[model samples]
Target: MSSTRKKSSRGREGSKNRRWSDRVTKQSNALDLESKIFKSTNPRRIALSLKRSAQASKRRKGTPYQSAMSMLNFYINRAGKSLSQKQKRVLERAKDELRDVFGRK
Candidate 1:
């Protein structure tokens, strides 16, 4: 009985590991452009950098303009709860400039 219980537990652990591995694989498939976005203090520079990074990444989905905007929105949504009002405003302006740079506007 104890051996059977151990076997069942091991099977459960294997399934859990597989799930974790799948999650990691999906996350790894996405382009991580957060560092470039956060490296600059100037909003226009940040926007330009993000646009360039998105254009360069083959792994990103959608057009370069869409990918750039998605990355910016993802960053803003991720930081929205913790960011200061001034910081949020800066990011918003960056999104506007990003649109202009990409001719999305």
Candidate 2:
């Protein structure tokens, strides 16, 4: 019984270690966006800045409009769980404003 307990504890420790390693790897591989969306309270400014950043990135896939929209959506989705209802609404409006600024339908 003692040996079984020891094995179970070791297995738990091994899983914890693996999770930590995975987190480290994910952090290193993460994308660093230049827009700093969370720091700004104004939806229009956030949209403009994100648009500029997306346009400047040569590595971004698709058209300029598509790239900008993708970045904005990614930020919103990544932040959705942590953001308040008001914040989410602001971001949704920003998406609309971004489309307007980009001349997208």
Where model 1 places Cα greater than 4 Å from the true spot, the runs are 1-28, 32-36
Over 1-105, each residue of candidate 2 has an lDDT whose tens digit, in order, gives 455533455666676665543343233223235434645678888778767766776775677678777666765676345678888888888889899889876
Task: Provide TM-scores for the models.
Answer: 0.65, 0.65
Spell out the clash pairs found in candidate 2.
Answer: none
For model 1, state the Cα shift of residue 41 in Å. Answer: 2.9
lDDT of each residue in 1-105, candidate 1, tens digit only: 355433455666677665543343235354545453553567898788878777788987788888778767766775344677787888889999999899877
Clashing pairs in 1: none
Candidate 2 ranges beyond 4 A from true positions? 1-32
Q: lDDT of all the models against the reference?
A: 0.70, 0.66
Q: In lDDT terms, which candidate is top?
A: 1
Error of 1 at 70 (Å): 0.6
